[model samples]
Target: MKLYQLKAKQAFPISKKEAWDFLSDPKNLKVITPDHMGFNILSGADRPMFQGQIIQYVVKPFPGYSTKWVTEITHVKEGEYFVDEQRFGPYTLWHHKHFIKEIEGGVEMEDIIDYKIPFGILGQIAQPIIVKKQLQQIFNYRETKLNELFGKLEGHKNYLELKSI
Candidate 1:
């Protein structure tokens, strides 16, 4: 099985508490996500994020493909980090970790996602042409959205990378 990993990091000119408050609230996901993805929270987003929390959503990853994704918040460490795992989703395996740290004059947010695609060999064939590009676009949009919401930290180079593991 081929497992893929995506790592993204961005620095923001905002306080750690401020960043935590925005990111910890599940509803804000729609704000950071690209509108073209047709992302919507179906349920389990009425309250603050916590361990064991289940969040469901409807997402159109591609045209004519709308799917219901259910993810469980498996871990949460207040203002530091949190983990979400896919319970029912498109991928065969989806584990995402989000972290935030206080940096000089701001806060830095990091995301690491490890996932395995379905359909085995066919999925591997489509990885570069479809999956990887889609993920890149999604993260790129998120970075832009976050920069607009909270100004970027000068001299901090943000990056996003995807690779096989």
Candidate 2:
């Protein structure tokens, strides 16, 4: 089995507290994720995140099928960062860390994920064809959705500035 890592960072034109309040909640995952992915949270998000918190969800990574995913919040540092590891999921291994920091204009949120597919050789072969692209699309969708929700931050503008035009 080969280990894979995906890193993504985005600056939200919002305060660290606001960022933490939204991102740290498991229910918000559905809001940011693509609709076709069939992301649904089966756990409550009313309380603040803490270590050993288990969140359950159903995700349809492929068409006509759904899989249940369970992740345990292993570490949390209030407004700074949190870590989640997959307890039962599609992948053989999944470790995800989320970090938020106060930057020049807003809060910078970063996601670092390490995952390995299960089917050994076959999974490795499908990495480039399917796994990699699917993961990238998920993160890309998140970035776009966040930009729509919070506006764009300085140094990360993707669209043409109206002032420049």
Candidate 3:
């Protein structure tokens, strides 16, 4: 089996506590996600982000089709990191780890995703082309969204003040 992994990192000019609060809440997903992909939470998990917490979502990456993805939180460390595994989703297996740290300037967040596409021969054939391409698209969107959100908060004093708490 071919193992595929994607790693992404970004630093925000925000405190670790603020970043933690925003990312810990599952409902903030759509606000930070790219609009073109049409990602929305289908069902907010019953429990907060913790080991074995399941989060269901409906995502439309392609036209005319909505994929239902159910991911479970497998590991979590408060104000630091969390891991979400896909129990039933499009991919054969998906394991994603989100890491956060308080750096000198601000908070740094890292996303490490290990996933395998369905079907043996098909996965090998499509990895270099299709799967990799889609991963890039999704991550690029995420980066842009983060910049915009943080940029707005930084430029507006009142907004930043309100979120200061």
Candidate 4:
């Protein structure tokens, strides 16, 4: 199977600690996610983020159908970055990394996601027509919601950029 990569970056007008506190807590994911996706966290919000943390959620990737996604926080470095890999989900492989850095004015948040679709040849066919576009829309919604939440940092044009690798 071929692995596809997506990278998204956004600068938030907030301190590194503030950004870490918000993003590290998986509970806040529902806040930033679009309502159309039906994203809901099944795990408790009180747990602290650490290696081996398991998070469960249900999302409607397509109309009238719900998919349960389970991911494990495989690696973490406080105030720096964290990695989450899918244990069970729609994709055959899902590895996502979130990075945060202290920039000039505020904190910069970046997300790198590597995923592979299932169904062999059919998956390849769907990647361009469906999966790619769907992922873009999801990230676009996230960027807008994040700007509304923390306000955007100065001097950045695009909130998120996606490309294959």
Query: lDDT: which is higher, 2 or 3?
Result: 2
Query: What TM-score quantifies how close candidate 1 is to the native fold?
Result: 0.99
- The estimated TM-scores of all candidates read 0.99, 0.92, 0.85, 0.95
Which candidate tops TM-score? 1
What does the lDDT read for residue 144 in candidate 3? 73
**lDDT tens digits, residue span 1-165, model 2:** 478888788888899999999999887889999999999887755567889999989999999989999999999999999999999999999999999999888988888888888888999888778888888888889988999999779786432111100
- How do all the candidates rank in terms of lDDT, highest first? 1, 4, 2, 3
Stretch of 10 with least lDDT, candidate 1: 29-38
Name the regions of candidate 1 deviating beyond 4 angstroms: none
- Note the Cα lDDT for every prediction shown: 0.97, 0.86, 0.76, 0.89
Candidate 4: global Cα-lDDT?
Answer: 0.89
How much is the lDDT of residue 118 in candidate 2? 88
* RMSD list, candidates in order: 0.5, 6.3, 8.0, 1.3
Residues forming the 10-long window of minimal summed lDDT in candidate 4: 156-165
Count of clashing pairs, candidate 1: 0
Q: Clash pairs of candidate 4? A: none
- List model 4 lDDT by residue over 1-165, tens digit each: 687888889998899999999999999889888798899888745598999999999999988999999999999999999999999999999999999999888989999999898999899888989999999898898898988989999897654555556
**Which ranges of candidate 2 are over 4 A from the true structure?**
44-46, 157-165
| lDDT (10s digit) by residue, model 3, range 1-165 | 777778777778889888888887788778776677688887855446777788999888677878999988889899999998998878998988888898766777888788888889887788767777777777776777877776423332211100000
